[model samples]
Target: MTAIILAGGKSRRMGFNKAFLPYGDKTFIEHQIARLNKIFDEIILSANDARLYAHLNLPIVSDILPERGPLSGICAGLIRSTSFHSFVIACDMPFIHEKIILYLREQIGGYDVVVPQTSRGLEPLHAFYSRNCIQPMYRCLNEGRLRIIDFFSEVKVKIVDEQEFKELDVPTQPLVNLNTPEEYQKYCDYKAPNQRES
Candidate 1:
C-alpha cells in the first residue's frame, strides 16, 4: 500500500513555512518523506505546490482544495492513490513510529480508516483513509465543516487503543506537534545531533 504525507499547511503558528524547518541537515518534509519511503510501496506527497516535494523523487500531488485544511489534502490523496486505502501523516510530527504504523495498516484490511486513540484524542493525521472517505469529505467541505473530524460518521473507523500502540519498540509521543517557533526549537534540541544528520 501507499502512504500520503500532508505537507501543505500554511504554518501560521510556526511563523514560517513548516515544511522548510530543519530537522537536522534536511527540511522537515525531507525527513518525513524519507521515513515513509522505507515502508510503503509508494510514498505520495500532498502539498500546495507539487514541485516542493519533487526533490524526494516520488509521486507528489497538489491539494484538491487549497487552504481548506487537512480534508483537502486527504481528498487529494484519496483521488490519487492507487490503493483502496492509504496511510497519512502530518509533516510536523517528527516522532512517528514505524512499528505502530505497520500495526495500524495490519488492522486496515476490513476498515476504511485505522486511527489511533491517545490520551489527547484520536490521531486522524496518522491514520489510514479509504476511497470511501472522498464523498463524505466533499460533503463536509460543501457544508463548511473542513475539520478532519467532520466525516468520522461516514466511514468504518478502527480506533487502535493506547495499549495497541504500546507494542511499538519505542514509546512514541503521538501528538508532539511543532506548530510554533518555541516548539520547533525544543524538538531541534531534543533530537540527538547525529540523528537527523541526513
Candidate 2:
C-alpha cells in the first residue's frame, strides 16, 4: 500500500505552513514521513507546488484539478499511486498512530474506503482509499462538489466508529490535528512535559 500526504492547503488559519511546524525533534511533515516510512514502501506527497517539498525526495504529485481542496489532492494522489490502495492523511496530523494505520489497512478488504468516524464526524483525510474511489472523486471534482465525503455514497464505505476504536485499544488522539496557532501551542506545551520526562 502507498501512503499519501496532503500538504497543499493554503493554511490561511495557521498563518504559515503547518507541515513545517515544529513537533518534538522533527517538523510535522518530517515526523509523518518517519512514521509512515515504517509501514509503506511507497509514499506520495500531494502538494500544489512540488518545489516546496522537493527536498523531501519522495514522489510529489500536484493536484490534477488545482485549488479544489483535499478532494483534488486525494484524486491526484490516487492517480499517481503505484499500489491499488493508499492511505491518505493531511500534513498537520502528527499524532496518527502506526497501529491505527495497520488497523485501517486490515479493514479495507471488500471496501473502497475505510474511514473513521469521530464525534466530530467523518475524518476523510485520515482514511484509506482504493483505486475504486478515483472515478467518483473525479465526478465530485468536475461537479464542483469539493467536500471530501461527497462521493462516499458512490463507494463501499466502512466507517470505523469510536466504540470500535475503544475495543481495539486505539487511542483517538491520533485523529487530532493542529489547525491554529493556539492548538499548535497547546501541542507544544503538552509535549514539553513529556519531552522533559524522557
Candidate 3:
C-alpha cells in the first residue's frame, strides 16, 4: 500500500516547518519517510511547497484544493493513490511508532477510515483511508465543510483502541507533536545527547 504524508502545515507556533526539526541524525520527516518506505510500496508527499521533501526523490503532490488543511491533503492523496488503502500521517507528529502503523494497516480492511482513539479524541492524521472517501470528501470540500473528522459518520470508520496503540508505547506519546521551540529543543536533547547523532 501507499503512504501519503501531509506536509503543508503552516507551523504558526513553531516558526518553521515541523518536518525540518532534527531528530536523531535526520529531520523528522526524513526519519518518518525512511521508516515508512520500509513497509509501504510507494510514498506520496502532499504539500504546497515542493522545496520540502524534494531531496528525498519520492513522488510529491500539492493539495487539489489548497489552503484547506489536512482534510484537503487527504482528499488529494485518496485521488492520487493506486492502493485501495492509503496510510496518512501528519508532518508534525514526531513519535508515531511503526508498530502501531503496522497494526493500523492490518485493521484497514473493510473500513473507509482506520484511526486510533486516544483519551482526547481520534488521531486522524495517523490513520488509514480507503478510496471510497473520494466522493464524500469532494462533497465535503465543495460544501465548505473542511473539518477532517466531520465525515466520519458518512463512512465505515474503525477506531483502533488503546490495546493496539499500547504496542507502540503509545499512551506515553500517542501523538507527540512539537509546537514550540522549547519542546523541540527538549526532543533534540533527548534524541541526541552530547550533540552526538543517533
Question: Each candidate's root-mean-square deviation in Å?
Answer: 2.4, 2.4, 3.2
Task: Write one digit per residue (lDDT tens) for candidate 3, span 73-124.
Answer: 8899888898989999888776656677788888877898998887767888
Report the C-alpha displacement of residue 104, candidate 1, in angstroms.
Answer: 0.8
Full-model lDDT for every candidate: 0.80, 0.88, 0.80
lDDT of predicted model 2: 0.88
- The full ranking of all candidates by TM-score, starting with the best, is 2, 1, 3
Better of 1 and 2 by TM-score: 2
Compared with the true structure, the alpha-carbon lDDT of candidate 1 equals 0.80
TM-score on alpha carbons, each prediction? 0.90, 0.94, 0.89
The best candidate by TM-score is: 2
- Superposed on all Cα atoms, model 2 deviates from the true structure by an RMSD in Å of 2.4
RMSD of 3: 3.2
CA RMSD (A), model 1? 2.4
